[model samples]
Target: MKKTRIAALAAVLAFAGATLPASAQTALSENQILQSLQSAARVAPPNLSAALIANAVQEHIKNNPGMPITWTPLQLLDGLAQINVQIQFALNSDIIRPESYATIGSIADALHHPILAGYKFVVTGNTDTTGDRMKNLELSQRRANAVMNALVTVFNVDPARLEAVGLGQENLQDVQNPTDPINRRVQLINVGKYLPGK
Candidate 1:
């Protein structure tokens, strides 16, 4: 695929530089590859996309205290497993809800520890099944803020260490069912982590 795009771009450049040698196209491809590599390096080390981080947040936190890294998105239920990083809430409610607190709390707890200290995070709010797009967006923002505030005020999480944002209803349907109960969630994303893989 990369070769294809490079070839296509080279062809265009070749067309414009008709008087130049065909070899010039090779330089263009080289340049294209160089740029691509540079960009990839920027997000290398399994850079977690917002989607993955969001999914992880919604999952229930069931990690052991000994582990350096815990992913709640991988909880098991009656032989079935639930992904951490996503937590559900009632319509229009910014409440941390129940059991769900375990997930977010563990994350805040992890960040509070000395090993993972110095990292930052984001609390993104989402909603499903009950409001107009604009209204949902506003509510989502409120919820995100509420969740962030809870982490800071109640859990002793640092205020400067986190951000709260509302994705509204977008990115929810990107997974399976758009209107499913699982779609309503809050995704916690860690800073300097979950970047794209090389």
Candidate 2:
């Protein structure tokens, strides 16, 4: 029985040797490795290993090029600090249209979740050139503030976690059209110190 256990441990070590990151593989102590394995045993289900999850994350990145994903859960054992969120608006309106409630709810849920709870957001409002530039600027600022209020009051995001600002028609999405629907949007860029954990 002891021999079989040693053999299994050896096999696990060899498997780790083949796939573990250089940082982890080199510095991870025997106890740490065993603990990691034990944790893995509890969390990983049948047909799924830590390596398989790593592979899926890699494949997801390879399959979807130009995305901002760089790390996986295996790498993010250390907690994250903050995250970004973007929301869009109609022309000259501060109200989050009823149709976009679901998306807004998802953002709230993400903000409330354990992974992204600590993050702060800058809710930037943008607009198309369908109206006067100065008016668009003022309107955009109002829209941005409205969004901030909705997120804080309606969605229950921490007021400290949000900042609302307006860019007006400055950063046009479809520069060629100058007033495209795609331009009328908000992008929640991860501002301070958070990367998307896969």
Candidate 3:
């Protein structure tokens, strides 16, 4: 099952990269990957698949707190799952609802941990499939930027270490039912390597 999930994730990332402009595909950096993923999130369902794979990776990490450093991107993602925070925003708007303050606080706390020093991350926003695709994508991007701003302004996280991207409804958590609430979520993808004792 782990192998299958890993393969699925690799395939999904590959397909996502293939969809980007040729100029953007030459050398894929973390920023490029984030950009490609965001673009794919706007027009394809692969983000949903990526999220599912990430969720599984997170679960694995949760089950084994002593996960080794010699792991794949999926495993590294699972191992560094602190970025999988859930924050709620106002309906159709980038404004975060009051009820989500706790989650935001937790994210702030996690990022402040000593172990995460020097780490760089990208904040990603995803949406359910309910409106115009382009609009949804734009909203997702705005929400992501909002989260990034909140973390930097409110939590004192270094702005240089963060980037925000929105993946619109291109990756619905429940494709068969695009309106599923689970589809709306915020995820943080690390741009730096995980150095356990750093």
* lDDT-superior candidate, 2 or 3: 3
Worst 10 residues of 1 by lDDT: 75-84
Better of 1 and 3 by lDDT: 3
Model 3 C-alpha lDDT per residue in residues 1-198, reported as the tens digit of each score: 323322222222222112232222133333333333323222212222334543544454455344122222233233332223346788788999876655555455555655555465668787766677568778988998898899899778877667777766554344554565556667766555433443
Q: What is the TM-score of each predicted model, taking all chains together?
A: 0.51, 0.51, 0.55
Across 1-198, the per-residue lDDT of candidate 1 in tens digits comes to 434433443332221112233233333453542232222213322433334544443332222223233222221111111111455466467766775555455545555655445544566666653557557767877888887887788779877666776656553522334455444556554444312232
Best by lDDT: 3
Off by over 4 Å in 3: 1-83, 194-198
Tens digits of per-residue lDDT, candidate 2, 121-152, equal 55656676677755776777787688778768
The lDDT, on a scale of 0 to 1, for candidate 2 is 0.47
RMSD (CA, Å), each prediction: 20.8, 19.5, 17.2
